[model samples]
Target: MSKDYRSFFGLSGPAFNKQIPAEAIYRYPHLEELHYYLAAAVADGAVAVVTGPVGAGKSTALRAFLTNLDPLRYVVIYVGYTSSDRALFREVAHGLGLSPSYLKGDLLNQLHGAIEHAWLGKQRSTLLVVDDAHLLADSLLTELRQMLNFQMDSATPLGLLLVGQPTLAARLKESQHEALSQRTLIRYTLAGLSRSETSEYGRAHMLAVDGDPDVFTAEAVDLAFQQAKGIPREIGNLCVYALIRAAWQEVRSVDRKVMGEVIQAQKGP
Candidate 1:
């Protein structure tokens, strides 16, 4: 292995089933309506949509929210993609561990049956969460919107949460899809971090990785926030690259020079 590789994988970043950082644990206010909608979806089954600009932390926030739910109480189906209605059904059914070879229509029926069985037998509610939902076709979305029909007159039983980029909101607003748009119980857009929030977020990512928060001077963080425009993933990528660049030169702290190099590398020719 290269010396660079030796240094890179040495740190203990939180992997799956590992710890959640305090900063990452707290879901920001803009997404709180989303949280409420998700809770209602699991309890009463509502259709919810969460949209945001690229790198705005929508996926991460959704993961954090879903992680907090009681596993025994909730059956969560996380679909990272659904290129078509058939694909969506297959993916959801697969996540729920249904037989993989069933027909698409049969899969849908089976999914509904499985959820109903759990709801009746154990009071376990199912939450269907689709992330990066923009790639989904209109027909597929229609099938998804119609799935709420599984509900009784009293409440929606098929809870749906769609997380996607801002384009998904535009798609919903098209004149052709009024019914789908109107059915959304709660809609949220994740905005980029605020100035103070950006600084604190950078510090937290550093602390999470056992790196020194003081490694980034306040000025460096300000520059990063300005350049990366307060996107959490960009903040993380930039900080990691900057720290690694610093470490390569055997520097204990990240200075302006190291940050500039990392930024330039990211913006390379």
Candidate 2:
């Protein structure tokens, strides 16, 4: 049987796994900014748009933000996909513990009633977070715009958060989406980590797993920051791969040479 890298590195658990607890996630400055924007949006019961490049940790930041919200004061509904109008409504309905309707109009009415009830009756704010929102068609986006139309547009009973790639922001700027775009109160783009932040991120993950932070030499960490372009997901993957390479070579610490080999293998034809 192959040797376990975690054992070789003295890791108590998997490093860089998606299942990592929110408290264990490294709080980059950008993530803190996102949390602030989200908090403002929820407070105003308005719309917010967060966009970033792939592996920029947009979803991770959102997850951490939602985890800390007071459940008694907020009803969080997450929609991961927006393939169709009905599917979108269905997901929201399910989140509110209501059966989805077959007709589009009925579904809209159902959602409006449920959201309003949560806000007015229970005094709980309803936050609808749509991930991968860049894939939403213009018609579907119009549906989202209508969702925010409450009390003759004078009051906002629901908070809508659109999270996706940078293209989602550009798409919102188009003339066809002006109505929805105008309603967005907060907008922020997530940036990747800086050189120092990248090193800290790697070391933080190592410490979270009960492994030695210095298991990766300074040179190795530098190469990782460069090779991963400061993206957290990419940096994590590179670090894990380098650890495996170091274990295979019977090295106690990952050096520049080990990271280089891992990078080369990753770029293979």
Candidate 3:
């Protein structure tokens, strides 16, 4: 029979699962700052850019912030994949529960009318979030900039949030994108956790699953921070893998030796 790690470790549920409740997520300082900037951007109907390294918890922070927003006051449209302007608009229309028009002009008009109605009629602000924006083509970027033009550029009923890797920030700095760059009112770069914060994050995940935090020794956590470089996702991955290895060996605690073995095994021959 396969070993039940959760049962063996006395955990009530799986640990390190990405689908964990938002309230159980560890609140890093950067997450708090991100929430503040996101809220400010939506309130001002402005544009914001959030960039970070891979596995730096950028999307996790974004999800947490969006979950806390007042649904009655704001309508959020999130698009994670888009290669062109049409695809982007179609995604937005779908998010609004409208059938996407086949023609570009019709689709654009449909999107505009939806945003207008949501703001003026329903009294709700529309916030559009595009993830992985670094891959956006220049033409698509230009289309996005044009979408912000409302009421002679005097009134902004829609807020735009572009989230991607650090390259997305660099892409915005080009002279060709100067117009769009100038419109960005808020920008924040997310960073990984500190060693202390890494330890807290590990313990928090354990506590979240109702597992004994001591399953990972302090030294093991210290080594994990060093190996994972304090990235929350990497830390969680390392801890979970280590736990599996410990369970296989019938060990109760993951110490420095067990952590080292797991790290070495991951490095391959």
Each model's lDDT: 0.74, 0.89, 0.88
Sorting all predicted structures by TM-score, with the top scorer first, yields 2, 3, 1
lDDT of 1 by residue, 1-269 (tens): 22351254344563111245534443556556667766775675667888988888787778778877898878889887856777778777787788755577677778888877777777777888988888788887888877767655554446888889999999999977788888887788888887777777766665566645577777777778888897877876787777767767877666778888888888998
- Report the candidate with higher TM-score, 1 versus 3: 3
Clashing pairs in 2: none
TM-score of every model?
A: 0.86, 0.96, 0.96
Full ranking by lDDT: 2, 3, 1
What TM-score, to 2 decimals, does candidate 3 have? 0.96
How well is each residue in 139-174 modelled by candidate 2, as lDDT tens digits?
Answer: 999999988888735556789999999999999999
Model 2 residue 12 lDDT score: 91
The parts of candidate 1 lying over 4 Å away from their true place are 1-10, 14-37
Q: Can you write out model 3's per-residue Cα lDDT over 1-269, one digit (the tens) per residue?
A: 53778877888888887877789889978888889888888999999999999999888888888999899988899998678788899999998889999999999888988888888888888899999999899889899989987763555789999999999999999999999999999989999999888877888889999998778888898889999888888888899999888888889999999999988988899
Candidate 1: Cα lDDT at 184: 81
The stretch of ten residues in a row with the least summed lDDT in candidate 1 is: 14-23
